[model samples]
Target: MFLRPEDAGTVTSPTLIEAAPNEQPVLSGGVTLTGWRKDGSNRLGLPAAAQGQVWVADVPMVGGRALAFRQLWVNGRKAVRARTPNDDNLPRLLTWDVDKQEAWITATAVGTLRQAGQLEMVLHQMWAVNVLRVKTLTVQGAKVRVTFHEPESKVQFEHPWPRPIINGKNGSSAFYLTNAVELLDQPGEWHYDGQRGQVLYWPRPGETMSSAHVVAPVLETLVQVSGSLDQPVAYVQFKGLTFAYTTWLRPSEQGHVPLQAGMYLLDGYSLQQPGTPDKAGLENQAWIGRPPAGVELAGVHHTRFERCQFLHMASAALDYQSSTHNDAVVGCTFRDVAGNGIQLGKFSDEGTETHLPYNPKDEREICTNELLENNLLTDCANEDWGCVGIAAGFVRNTTIRHNEVSQVPYTGISVGWGWTKTANCMRDNRVTANYIHHYAQHTYDVAGIYTLSAQPGTTITENRVEEIGQAPYVHDPDHWFYLYLDEGSAGITVQDNWCPAEKFLANANGPGNVWKNNGPMVANAIKQAAGLEPAYRDLLAEQIKKPAANGAQVKQ
Candidate 1:
């Protein structure tokens, strides 16, 4: 029944407040807009021009519409500008143009949010905010709680590229390489150990195999299978992306799984070495393999590796030499390398380059092309050791951060930039938050970290280092010592880093070096040690041996 105009005022509610023209009306009482207050008594009718700016408390109630609390209103005067809280659960639903797939969100926030297969952030009116930071992403089952910057800005996750590859493989370098190139168009699935049935790589006469087409070989040693077969190779091409491989060991029962873009799970399998150490108790299989020439692992642009493990590599775990940008290797493990564990910036002898320098001068004098970040290593000492754990030659924009290195015979992480070229070649390379321990055993001048002649502006910060010894007289002068900064390496800031120094290291006693933050933990430990030097030393020594206690740790 249609109520008379006179009777409409009976349902008056005093708690409701009305807004003047050009103002957003705020409801006073708790009984606000729920499609229930249709009575004309307290209804704040709008002028014709601003009518759409406010939703009537109950215009739709006459029909079979349910009285719901959530309603979207657009500020018609503002041209559909949106605003809402940054809380994902409390997202204020704006006037969604469903047909056009356009949403108006107010402010912007930084941090990762899950959308289908990728992790990303949302921006709204990007010019409105200054620093766009998507600081964190917390995943709770299917519910992702995102915290953002502006309460008003809305963001959309529409674009999707190929996801960056994350964990894969275990202890087998052959399997690691194979998994790295799984998406490429190869003739057959990559295989290891030829006798088990599939094609494998072995040394043959003049095979002419490109890096893309080569297969895992079965060595003639019978114990370490290294042989090559006649198989078509594949050249893998890519653009901006990241691929992280770690934690795997080959087995007869379990098969090798390929690496893909995005976060992946790795399996912990066993690796069989050819023989045991002459001194150690275990007889492990030992057939360390070497990487073929020009084998590319990472590509150009914005990649990161966190908490990865590398094992049983006859060659480098990472063979990236291209002029890449914004790449990082973080929170990873490297062990048993026949070659370098994390190899950087490839080399070519086409012109008159000769053999690649152990650490190139031209590499570090450039921009940040590669970085080794927060990586850990153990049990990497080997009889046939070839290179450092993290080696960068002729590269730039490299940062080694919060890394915990141990048990490697060679240098832990190194930078040899500008050695081939000018003195000021590498710029803005930072080695920070690293805990390098127990190194320089097999190799000498083997610092916890070494930077051969790099350019100026290379900073080493907040590194807690221990157990690095001077190289024996017989080893190359380049191989021994802790914190080796040689060959015109200046503007180097060694600040706030801990090291077990027999004495202060002096390189030619030149003037330009900056040593700001240098100290030892023993002094601090002695304070807590309550005057017992032996007890304090023993306790501190034990803590340093454990991986969890030693490195620059990522706070949860």
Candidate 2:
């Protein structure tokens, strides 16, 4: 909570903070971590096979630093960050060099892996993801090289395209090393140690560390709502809210590259002078950065967020962050967000240049008419596997309809940004009858309604988009699709979308695009009229933690 604005000027009136009718109100940014003194988990350095099953704590510092978060939340779920091929296996990546940003790992003793610069690898790269940070691991014969650190290791080896592909397509590219206190031997696993501010659990089953309930996330952006573009921040309204705990430590401070729906990648490169008047021999050059939002509006306008409930955030859960206009996120309910569950408008503003094309001479900086209807995005980009469940960049008339999005990992409704097929500032965007299902769950060249650049009266109609989740550590399991209009998808208008065959992916599209009557003979009344519209279908049984008396939704 930056705590400034106590009359620091500029708030041209018009604000109304709802929720008193059936009371929802939960806006927390977490910080409850009482004393918790258990100590000795092998003197708290934990490694002799988790030295008598880890459990130690003392962190708690708050305003004076050292609470060290990476997501904890004990009493109400989420707690397993000691990672290292734990459970979901995740290892392969036996050689890479992208000019020495290094990575070898076939694995072997490798000097018993201890802190090693607070370790954190998480590399899985097919369509973006590059955590890195290790900086030295050596053994190099039967493998285990690793390297990286500085400036995200030169922006993850000269950032070209969602990078880190070694062999390509379903092969050498899956990783996960994570915050190791020597991977704290199982039981719900944990570990934080920010150089001994300590905290190292291992409880699970009937946990009881003197009345359990931890909680760590200490604010990244709880509810900003600032104003500018000529004193905006107009008629604000936030009905029945819930937005909970937030924290996205900037990939533990400097080392997270991403360049797709999740947006990180502070500075990408590759452009030896690649054309781009409307994109032709265009050489990438990204800039992105915007993740951190548990409700963060900016230069707002007719603001509105009905039935709100973007839960447990660590990154992007409701962010109309730009000169937002006629805002409206109808029946909101983005679950367990880790990144992107509705991040409409402007995706290249860390200094612009994300392939240019974002024309704005003050059309109020352009995020016009936004309105995501019947929303209920579930699970949501769980720990940023390249986030997306409705991420709309450089928006104009945005109006995604009947939203239903499912468990999501990568791309389940992402719309235009400047990959450029010319024509800037986007146009009349509108993805209709949305239902997008299971989704790539882990990263692929994704698409269940994906798009990029040039949007002139955009229209992806009657979307039902089927299952599509088969993650076995993807690089490209048959690429993936069900409406992907990537790279300069111009003047869009894809018709009657259903999906179960006729796959769909129009990669370098441009010039008045249009594809009619999409897939499986498109019928069944357009796949039963897409999703969530019978007055929001009770938000498809909404839930981030809904349980008592059968509310359901805590399964993913």
Name the candidate that leads on TM-score.
Answer: 1
lDDT of 2 by residue, 1-556 (tens): 2212231222366355677876555767776665565555355446666666566777877668776678887776778888777755577777778776677876553336734768888887887677777878877567778787888888888878877667765678788887867777678888887777877787788988777777777777777777788766667677876767778887887878888877878778887888766566978777877777876777877778888787778888888878878878898888878888888888877887788887878789788988889888988878887888888888988889988998887788888887778788898888898898998888878988889878888898988988888888888788888888888888898998888899888888788998998988989887898888888888776545421221111111
Per-residue CA lDDT of model 1 for 1-556, tens digit only, reads 1111121111232111122444322111011112221113221211232222222222222135322211111110001111112122222212334234333322222112232111112221100101112223345553333332221111111111111111211110110011111111222211111122112221123322232211111111111111111221112122211111111112111211111000011221112442222212222111111232112333234434443344333334555545355555554555544345666653322232211232344342232556665455554423223245666655555677655667665666777632222343355677776666776654343467666443457787666667764322212434355576754455567766666553335453223578764656434432232211232222223211111111111111
Q: Assess the local accuracy of residue 197 in candidate 2 as a C-alpha lDDT between 0 and 100.
A: 85
Candidate 1 Cα outliers beyond 4 Å, as residue runs: 1-295, 346-369, 381-383, 418-421, 469-479, 502-511, 517-556
Once model 1 is optimally superposed onto the true structure by TM-score, how far is the C-alpha of residue 120 displaced, in angstroms? 53
User: What TM-score should be assigned to candidate 2?
Assistant: 0.36
Report, for every candidate in turn, its global Cα lDDT versus the true structure. Answer: 0.35, 0.77
Candidate 2, 130: how far from true, in Å? 1.5
Clashes (backbone N, CA, C under 3 Å), per candidate, total 73, 1
RMSD of each: 30.0, 19.9
